[model samples]
Target: MDEIATDNRQGILTRIRWKAGYMNPALRRIADRVLKAPDEIKAISIKDLALQCEVSESTVTRFVREIEVQSFQHFKILIAEELSQGSSSTPPITDRHVYEDITDQDDTASVLSKVAARYAMTVADTRAGLPAEALEKAVLAIEEADVLGFFAMGASLLCVENALLRFMRVGKRCLFFRDLGIRKFSISTLGPKSLAVGVSNSGRSISTVDSLRQAKAQGTTTLAITSFPDSPIVRHADICLFTPTVTGVIGPAEYHESMVSKIAQLQVIDVLYSLYAVRNFGRAIEGLERTSDVTALTRY
Candidate 1:
């Protein structure tokens, strides 16, 4: 295998940690092994690494490719280079180990530090991991859509609410409903000129997936902001925007999305809103001024 140029790459380990959250069980084991022991990985052969991670040799190849490395040799070379440098491309979060979960043995200060680190890392990694092409398509869809419909449930709904508020200020017609029946009805009313965005970290939420499904059936452009690239939501989405799976900072086996996931999703929302506003600068500013004026009246 041809060696990948280490100089051309930035933060190989950071990329692995970011993408690890969305990986399948087998691939995740490989990633966990690599992140935990880069020095060991650099010295281990592919066959040995595969055996150690309890995955097949092919799964090891897939993990390397998923992180955009060309081959296992190239992956090890990069790890070796990173190790020789004596530091990671991404700065360390406090003095604590990366991806260390908050434990009950910690005090209030430790919790604060860990939570802050998680938030910072989630934002940085998410920004790095998002696909530019998909983001561009999502922005264009929003710019051209006659109406925008957001579908999410649970903590994911908080992200939707923030998007609704921000987009509304920029004069976008947005729809969101907490009630499933009402949300489904609202989504059903949207047709070809509308955009449907479903937010789900797991990508398996029944309501969110069904809402995207309903939108696609109506020929509305569908966009998904999810951690899992192959999740059910992606099957219905015309465009998919990914956020780093912040699961690294929390329990590894925790299936439910955490508060850190919301932070990551919120950052995606802010990016989308900013890009849309930039594309519609004049109208966006005017709408913002108008809305600000109206909202100011209610304040004091």
Candidate 2:
């Protein structure tokens, strides 16, 4: 239900930049050209832009809608406004190719710096792109739900497990299953008062998407945490939270679901958990105290 605000040029451009990496090969070609030459794009017609990108004119139209704009003219209008600002205070992300890949020749210091920068950008982009109203709705849904179910596969499960621990520590009833069959079966039991949260970096994982779809069929509120806004997972979610496309930007093809993306997903989980706790402060505090006291006895 959350929609990106398209009133400003920055919003339109930011969405394009964030989603460029994940777009299909044809769209990426178009996106790459647009970002590198926004000034040129403003003056060029859609037919010309398509010819330059070597894609069809329809693909150009699809790219505009993919960025959530109403039409190509609208897209060009926003770009013109951005250029007319005259200050050049804000620069487009695509102006240069800065995302670097780690190589065999890299030193520890180089790896550390590159990775640190990647994480920093992931956090910032995720924060900027995430919809405020969607987040608020997710937090409220978690707080009101009689029970919570977290679903995910592969590295994305890290976010699911983390949420399971954090929310459970605050005395909320939650469930997670590593087994696909168990997950599907458990989802079937959830009713209108329950919430189903699916975490997927690519948002195309069949297990995760189908789980959300199944949950929705059961009348449970569904939420999705993913990097792709237009992904298959969004169709099934009642509320959706999006992370920035980190792996898409820094590509070696193998890093599609890398830890860099996980950092963004985890950040979303941390914010959701924090907000839920604040809303039920007294109960959450008391639950934390009790859990801490019990766990303390296990410590050496």
Candidate 3:
């Protein structure tokens, strides 16, 4: 995955100063105070900040507006970004009393229930947010393409390989590439008559992004199935499909959020396969019969 550029405190302070130049004197003074002591101001309430700056609450509000942030809450994100860049050590806990109040509740049943609930929520959110237009476009692209290339890396590679099998069963010409080198080779060879689909939950996989780029350069229609539309993969894709997945470190454990995203992608492929079958009903029926005949010979 492509690394996301982290914003630092200096960067935020610089932006604030640049924006402050265009603001009225009252609003600019408020911005100057906040930028001068960002850490101190971050800990202060907006009301307290307004009081400290000797400005009306509206003036403080106007200051945030001049900086292009929605509100003080968003402005604090810049401060947090700055603090994060400077802090090598862990953050100090302000809520020590809460930690002391915690009792031993780490039962297996409780853990299982929480995990199941999180997974269920992921699935529900992904299904609810499925884009209808993107889904239809992907289905049509697969159905009409001379060849369909499926590319994924890490856990998503498993999903793409399974989808290749499913597409093959329905008489589609499909190829699945889990190997990075092979993926690049295939993309270079594929032509405009082909379609390339890549799956990545983070949408930052370098290999997946590179493969899509190569495919597009070769005149192939590129599609990206990912959880984030704002990711690098989306930029190179002709069609972008998305699913909902929470972003975080899951420790040394398997990622349940990514699993949910994979399930959502598979559901999309299933829908595409069904549509393709309906559109080419006679051909699909003939293919099924041929497979049944081969099975009959083995059974006897």
**Candidate that would win on TM-score:** 1
Candidate 1 segments whose C-alpha is farther than 4 A from its true place: 1-71, 74-100, 249-254
Q: Please provide, for model 1 over 181-268, each residue's C-alpha lDDT reduced to its tens digit, 9 standing for 90 to 100.
A: 8987898789899999999988889999999998898799999888765468888998888777535321232346577888888999
Every candidate's lDDT: 0.80, 0.78, 0.66
What local lDDT score does residue 123 receive in model 2, on the 0 to 100 scale? 79
Write one digit per residue (lDDT tens) for candidate 2, span 24-74.
Answer: 889989887876767788889999999999999999999988777788998
Clashing pairs in 2: none
Across residues 175-277, which tens digit of lDDT does each residue of candidate 3 receive? 7655677767777767898999988877788888988888898799998887654468877899876655533211111233355556666766666677778
User: Order of all candidates by lDDT, from best down to worst?
Assistant: 1, 2, 3
Evaluation by lDDT, superior candidate among 1 and 2 = 1
Q: Which ten residues in a row have the lowest lDDT in candidate 3?
A: 1-10
**TM-score of each prediction:** 0.72, 0.70, 0.60
Task: Write down the TM-score for model 2.
Answer: 0.70
Off by over 4 Å in 2: 1-14, 17-100, 249-255
Model 2 lDDT-worst window of ten: 246-255
Ranking by TM-score: 1, 2, 3
